[model samples]
Target: MADLFFESIEGVKKPYIDSLQRLLKQLRSPFAEGDDVGIKLHWGERGNRSFLPPDYAREIAAWLMDRGAKPFVFDTTVLYSGGRRTAQDSLNTAASHGYTAEFLECPVIIADGMDGKNVVSIPAGYKHFPTVQVCNIFEQAKGFVIFSHVKGHMVSLFGGAIKNLSMGFASRAQKQRMHSDYHPVLNKKKCTRCGLCVEICSTKAATISEPEYPKYDLKKCIGCAQCIAMCPEMALQIFWNSDMTVFQEKLVETAAAVWKKIQNKSVVINALLNITEECDCLPGKNHIIGRDLGFISGYHPVAVDEESLKKTGTDIFEKAHPGIPWQRQFTYAREIGF
Candidate 1:
């Protein structure tokens, strides 16, 4: 079992902050003095308020910096065309979300360069990808901390350390590969060419085929599934093959590869507040399914997520996104010695 740290949601005192400090201290110099450490966070989309507050990130950065480690907050640009599709836009969105250096006392770097094209490939030798296109900054960091907001997801069923590292750390191309197996298939029978898919497609993968028929270009699709969510007629369906389990396994494999690269110089902290039913990738407000449970941190990425799920008192994510087999991530992670 991994040595986990917890701060309960009890007492009048600010035990949450204390727990974070104690967790950092317990890590016991995961990075040497003057080492550059990466702090990964999901700067939530515009109109979305369920993300982990910048205050928590600031505290963590301050703690790390005070300990002589150089920490910088970062996140890769999203694959979809949204407020954070480009690096500049992402940084701007982060600032709008209060991730400014003035507030956090650290620079916010977009791991990938402008247009989300900057990438360095690493050989995972996994079942799906021979090499995963990890964002350049992740490979460049000496030590790293994944500051994840624990929430339910649409495809993977849960978003935590593994999801963060798998999709969060990858370049746009890598993200595409991971999502390739689950691309959207347009159902022509219920055709209603409202052009919602075309308007919402950030990659311009969806287009009208004239006479009210919507055509999708698979080669052009980055697989963000925005069309599926935007379709009013519910005409878009996932191309579910035998590769669904492989998708989760590939994510675990990529995460394992990243852990192997960083070795013992990494930590994962999960903020369990505002437990929403969807990932922060989507824009706008969402319904919260669970109350706050404070924060949990540990060196084991897989174990931290497992603990988070167990604390939910039920398979909340599985219930939220049925048939996703979310636990397969942990199983595969352990199988690869994560």
Candidate 2:
């Protein structure tokens, strides 16, 4: 068992600042004096207010700066279409959430470049991905502090420090690989063969045969799944198995790649506030599945997540998101020593 540091909300003598300070005190920072540290956290999506508070992030930044270190809060653009799909939009969203440099007393960086192209490919040597694309920011920083807002997820069942690194640190292309389990299978009966999918496909993966039906060359396909949405006749369908297990495994392997990038210069912080039934990416009122808890920090991502689940009475996320068990993340992370 790893040494997990925690501060319960009820036991906190003071409020946010005090709890944050105590948590920080218990965890050792990998950064040294004058080193640039990246504080990796999610900037809430548009219309979503369940992200980690800016004030708490500011307190961490201030603490780092006080230790003669240079700290900046940052996150990469998301893969799916949303307000945070582009680097500029992500920065704007962060600013809207009061994560501005002036407010945090530290600069904020959009890890991936303008079009989400800025990345460094690290060979993870995993079952799914031979290599994972990590944002350039992770390479630039001497250390990282992952601030995660714990919650339930549709695929992974629970989102915490592991998901934050696997999905959060990866570039858009790498994300496509992790989610490649669901290859689009065309429903030929419903296909009108309007050549819409052929026109929309960038890789020429979907091609029209002699008559009209579109033939998919899985070899050429990068698994982008762009053509699935372009089907006008609703002909495309996904193989809906619980592919989430493999997806979650690949997700953790990517986290291993990120952990390798930073070596031991990383910290995991999980804030058990506003424990929602779903992730923050979707825009809607999150149904509270678990009561507000406190915060936990640890040097190991897996340990922190294990402890977080334990404190929340264990299996809470599993109960909230049945059929999508999140334990695979920690199990794999530990197996790989990530």
Clashes per model (N, Cα, C within 3 A): 0, 0
lDDT of 2 by residue, 76-109 (tens): 8765556787778888888988889999999998
- Residue 52 of candidate 2: its Cα lDDT? 66
State every prediction's TM-score relative to the real structure.
0.80, 0.84
Candidate 2: misplaced stretches above 4 Å?
A: 11-15, 182-216, 222-242
What is the C-alpha RMSD, rounded to one decimal, of candidate 1?
6.1
The lDDT leader among the candidates is 2
lDDT of each: 0.78, 0.79
